[model samples]
Target chain A: MTHEAGIPLGIRFKLLSDTPQDSAAQVVNEVVIGDYRDLDTLREFARGCDVITFDHEHVPTEHLRALEADGIPVRPGPDALVHAQDKGVMRARLDAIGVPCPRHRIVTDPQDVVRFAAEGDGFPVVLKTVRGGYDGKGVWVVESAEEAADPFRAGVPVLAEEKVDYVRELAANVVRSPHGQAVAYPVVESRQVNGVCDTVIAPAPGLDETLALQAEEMALRIAKELGVVGHLAVELFQTRDGRILVNELAMRPHNSGHWTQDGAITSQFANHVRAVLDLPLGDPRPRAEWTVMVNVLGGDYPDMYSAYLHCMARDPQLKIHMYGKDVKPGRKVGHVNTYGDDLDDVLERARHAAGYLRGTITE
Target chain B: MTHEAGIPLGIRFKLLSDTPQDSAAQVVNEVVIGDYRDLDTLREFARGCDVITFDHEHVPTEHLRALEADGIPVRPGPDALVHAQDKGVMRARLDAIGVPCPRHRIVTDPQDVVRFAAEGDGFPVVLKTVRGGYDGKGVWVVESAEEAADPFRAGVPVLAEEKVDYVRELAANVVRSPHGQAVAYPVVESRQVNGVCDTVIAPAPGLDETLALQAEEMALRIAKELGVVGHLAVELFQTRDGRILVNELAMRPHNSGHWTQDGAITSQFANHVRAVLDLPLGDPRPRAEWTVMVNVLGGDYPDMYSAYLHCMARDPQLKIHMYGKDVKPGRKVGHVNTYGDDLDDVLERARHAAGYLRGTITE
Candidate 1:
């Protein structure tokens, strides 16, 4: 968000949003209420900016190409961004580069889905729409042919893949520059609840040293191969066999790296700006031995600020970041980060603060 | 500034300035072009705010009291703020509370200044206007009767004090909430060049442990005695005789505490906001053993961004905080903060980045 870049570095940020009430629009310097799909609006917004980047990957790629063709610099240009925008493209590209990924194939017929499952572990293959999916949407774990028919109803190209038997989900975040420089953060364990990221622990406690190193190297390689000129987050699956499989790629700052805001020497947001601007990358060293970050989801509490006093008073070391948004049930309203020498203590503090904010815990 | 507070916490900040072109206006949520001297304007501006605070200590105390009387929350109320606004008041109160301060007296006539000089060390006494002075303004080191006439020109009462022969200057910064909770930061050595703060070294390298503890206690005591509702910076003179004399007090975030942005667990700006809002204060612990901060004054270079690539590339750990302002020679445009385990290395990196930004150093 502009809060991360504009404040610390004093960058003049102008946001383009569909409405004035967008969380970022409320905080940035200028807000142009317009649709990103409209080229005229995009041109008008780009006029005042030195470089163009993104918070979401849903922006049309052709529009980005048009802007780049007009001599405007677009970070993580369409070539690299498409891999995140389309699952089919990402799977093919990773396969070509010998990157570990789940067995996948673009399927026009439901029979191909069954065949993929039959060739692999059989049934319960992952079906994805390949485009326009986020936060568990357009994704399904199908066991039988009847359940697989749901994805085909959307009339979009469906990508079927073998669901790996993984110990846990992990994320390796890195930022790259146009100058061929890149820095990788420690691999972290990301816990999900109802397909939404609920908590993340940096350095993935008890993770195999070799696997952690391999995850970081794989992310760095992806940044180089894809020519990603900004933050690249490579979500991975740590299999029971100790092999790492690439699951997803995000070309912007990821939720898994949010702990870096307070725990790392230089935050991922600050590094993202530097990478996109072609400035030197910052040191991705942790300030503490262990850091735990827990997302604060909206619940029955409408006035979030009311809970701040107790949370702050209870844990003075916790760093809470709240997005300026109207609270909605199950929405990610904010996050709490706690870091220290003791992993258990840090985790307890972070989880307690987050739970308190969500009105799930009280004392 | 609001840029640091507003952006990080998603707070809607509206700054009241004399002009729309003020650097803070360029980055804040809104700017109301009005004079702080105009009570009507202040009232109108306060109508939209929950709480009121300031960046400078020059605002009329009477106006602040009036706003508080009207049910608006004025942090560090007029009673506490006046100590920082007037030197005579601060000296009298600190003296009454047995706080260590230079021998001083309020003088109405020029002859009183001459008599005070004779009573003290005889000649070369420090004379300062009791009100409306900052950054070397309204202060004079008078050695003769004729030299004392300059301060009378301001038509304000002057305070004369013994000129302490000190080894160096130190600042102990602390923040307090309305509930009387306070946290003290590590004392830092503040180096002044031409009456302006040039660089600050946190934990004051080679400083005695007892002196550091005494400085922090003094600052905390001052905050408690004054009922300060936000940040209180106690500037002290570290005499050659191993004594600490209170030199000045600031009721807001001071330049001396800027090192906290990158060095400490919680920044002064964040603490100030927390204090004013009556939220619990954050931990004031240092993230590193040593931190060095250097101010960047504008020089011959009109294009400051042109030098950033080199500065960032050279020292990726340097945290640069630039004020969105036009380049004016000798004007404070930005600052750089560097922290590490090595004091010498941290100081070198900070100085190099700041000097390069000011075009004082090349390569």
Candidate 2:
């Protein structure tokens, strides 16, 4: 958020856990974290805050219910959060709402998967551990019958999906306030590698205007249906048939909306603040005609600061952001945002900066 | 700067001075008053610096001369600063360069001024104290022959201008590096109250693009002629005859270019850092179609923070930059920069933020 504004744009952090004292020290005045296990601690922290929201849906349903009971305002309340937090619940709820989701089957053992895969509905079947799976973890692609054996005894509920070939991935982000006002940023196209986001291009180049509108409508429907308070990121798959399919959902600031940090009228962070605080939501229009954002994998550089400076001096428009973190390999350290009048111009800036951080000589 | 980008930007001050215990620790980093009195001390402190320039050009001319003498690199060297430092020299130089300037007669005595105003120019001549005047101070507008007595006896070197009829004042800021590369930001229409800049609108709405270009060209010519190092701000007047006249020159970062700090592709500070360091220049393009900057006067409010918060909440795009200072009437403590696709869009943002800071509301 700091790098996107090319200056410090304000985004206050609200930690729902007590383990972030060191991080709290970094921002002495702006943030207040609570001991999640202590209801009293959580209540005390939430009282004076302008808005009550979550980074993740880990807060107990009762705690959220209690906050709502006291009029303290738990954003996506327990009722809505349950649908987003549990994949099975989301599928059931979304299916009930007539939203298109991938065909899936729940199984407790390997025999059900074998029975499903041999029907030849697909060559490869995708197995997913429904809860607590992120990135590419907790997912498997099984080709034949023998390879799917471990899941029966893995002690995790398994969900199988038909492998569908799609054109690309798309994300539609909508910011909503308590007043029932919502604004949508441009649908962004994202590239994923090993289940981690690599880059996001705003406005989703080559996207049909009608389809884009449909995607936004879908995102807004889910946000309104679930009564999301801040931001909702609706991930979608753009199939070769020019259809968008529901992939997943995130109820807070998501990686897909990062491009808006620098490209749009109001960064997601600031807009999130506005929405949660019940301030008027800002225009979600893109400042530049086109913009792209790339996530920096920590393993890409030894000295992120020096490397970041090199990128900055080379292309002042390349807004590079480095999380104050120790770099390892393939960790999502931070990201860079770039914009221009054309997609090629903005995309080059994003790609080149990411390549520089990745030690590749990008064009 | 703290108030503008907000405290969230975290731009720390690094004070360089000599003497281990001088009174430099009040705000910024180590106020190491580097001994400019000695060459070794100067070089040691300046070593490995990204840019060696001035806060304001008050360094000994000989010191700059010596730096240039040793090929140590200096901008606007003694030669250029001399013109800015002396009123007589600037007038003479501007005249020699075939630029339009108000008719002027250098007067060392009171009787000489009265005689010149009476003979040809008539009544209502302006008297100015050369070299150290800013705001409305050190200047006098005389409507009659009897009004020149005080300055005539104060032993101040006074020069007189024809007081031409100017429709509006404008500023053209151009930056250049040692390699002779230069770029100019859009010309801005300036509004001044008591000779202190109150507001600036970028591209000067209704300004002729051709004429604005001509004004920019003239500023570039002066920058090249003066061998300006960092940035050169040219104060110009659009006369009734549709001709532009040069009024004043600033050799360092000037108030007029503050909008670029947030609205331009390359900020003036970042560009200055590049220029003084003799590095490759960044893009000087204006990202927004329109931008407005309003100076925040100190005395208008008892406290700036509350107003700042109000402004932030009202308009998230208002980039309020307050130079940490105590409030006093008519004092420039900070400025707010707002930009958008339309002139009115940004102008409204700038105006509301300023009005809030000034404790005034237009309903």
Candidate 3:
């Protein structure tokens, strides 16, 4: 998707792929196949690049610091990226900044987890590994000490947080340039299914205007506070009491902002490119009254082209985006976006197209 | 641009680029570096490809026929493509179909060109080669027999056309599927400078509604009559008396439709991809009330990045699209699109950004 956004800017991409069949590798012309974890490989890959950025935050912090020492410009440099790479660091930083967050503390063992949970909301606490986690992996909700043993079994440092009763999930997407210029897209409601993002609606229909502005401000402040560059997706929880808490932070374009591709004046991916390159940011205003995005998860059927045809025929206004990945059950292979005056109509249209493309709906 | 559109659709492009530095070759991963005119190269490139399409109409007609004989689905098949490749065939066909066209005839020599001009609006007749011409090449506007001798020197059949005293140039862009599904974009005013397209304004501000509809209908009819599958751009000369005359025909996406990339609901390139792939076509409606596109021709400055940064900072809403081509004097390397409710604002913004990007305008 970043490659797609870069094309019109006349930007050339030199990608480092783990395999030739990787989704991005299928499209990018200049690709070096190597393990990103290897310092030597990272050095070789960064040789001719003007600025280095990422789609994933898995590159080791030490390697990024090394690259910076070697005079390579690494966006969202290791100091800022570590907040996203480690939950403990993120929680500590947010606490220091007085940003609203779930009550959290580092726990050493199952007994420590019990103590941490008791200090907060008690039992049913969320325990997350400080590193190497995504899409709901490396996190657990335990009701008791016995149930908490599972999170400590991995032997990695864990952070326990009070599980707040939230009304729904929202995302505040913002882009920040190295020069500090920034823009925030409207807050959006995000729905998750089986730990993966399923749908997103821009402006978060029926959201309080004040709360939306607050979320936007909080996201912008987070970007500045962390010295982050590029896209900052603040996954948020809107509590039943009307307070919003930061749930997670991502330093790259996130799934929740995909609707901007067809809905906003500037897409998140495009703005991310602009931000990382330190070019002026484009407008983040919505182009339509309502925009809905639904993910097309891979399912029982692998032949999606026929379904894609059906969806296109069904809705001429539908914008379908597919990642060139071989279909695998439950994997996000594509998404559909629809926008119009009526939110219900747009939502239904997007949902139908995504379902059809995923082969979940026949007619 | 086609490659950029194909990315979101997950279409894998196999480009047959004449050089490694060809604009499309720079982005597309699967590229075969070879001369497209070579029959063996074309055949080898076509193998395993689901269909064959083109960015240019220069591929030999006979070679396309051979490919069709080999059972490859060639869009805008040789028969339909020949009209775009040969001006004489195009003029004759449009005349037979009762489509309005500039007065033209095949001229044997300079003396015949003079004779042909006498029958029409007299001197200042335009001369065009029957084959191999684009962007003002292989074309001449002669005031007398002596000036007409240059076109005959090419040895190819020359087409003599009366230079219509046009009030303005307009373009009707349409896309047609092999299954006959077709959609016409709103007619746009095309402004030319030194015979090259300089700017395009969608919905042709102040255009007569009836004439705009007539032009669109004419383009749609021409697409059907020619059996064109994919985009067909009918360049028109809106006469001083309000009649629209066919200026030229392009079987693939044309420069006049570049505004659709950021101005329309579905871009011409994306629709062309859908049409060629036999997929359902997308909507061809303009997204804004007024949209303007200005071509950024290469100029004295070869370092465009600094100029690009300046333009982006100047107008946050301006959308710039570069073709990834090396800068060369008077060559089209990129374009800028600006759209909004006010036509004048849109036009000025686009022109200024384009001029700035071309290094022709400072401050």
Top-lDDT candidate index: 3
**Alpha carbon deviation, residue A294, candidate 1 (Å):** 0.9
Flag the better candidate by TM-score, 1 or 3.
3
lDDT of candidate 2 over B273-296, digit per residue (tens): 556655555677787888889988
Candidate 1 lDDT, A219-305, residue by residue in tens: 999999988999999989988998999989999988999999988878898899888888888889888899999999998978877
Query: Model 2: per-residue lDDT, tens digit, A175-270?
Result: 888788899998989889888998899889889999999999999998888888788899999988888888888887888998886688677866
Candidate 1 lDDT over residue span B166-267, tens digit each: 999999999999999999999999999988899999988888999999999999999999889999999999999999999999999999999999899889
The list of candidate 1 runs beyond 4 A from truth reads B1-3, B6-10
DockQ leaderboard ranking: 3, 1, 2
What's the C-alpha lDDT at position B69 in model 3?
A: 98
Error of 2 at A57 (Å): 8.0
Model 2 residue B216 lDDT score = 93
Q: Which residue pairs show backbone clashes in model 1?
A: none
List chain B TM-scores, each candidate. Answer: 0.97, 0.86, 0.99
The TM-scores of all predictions, comma-separated, are 0.97, 0.72, 0.99
Model 2: residue A183 alpha-carbon error in angstroms = 1.1
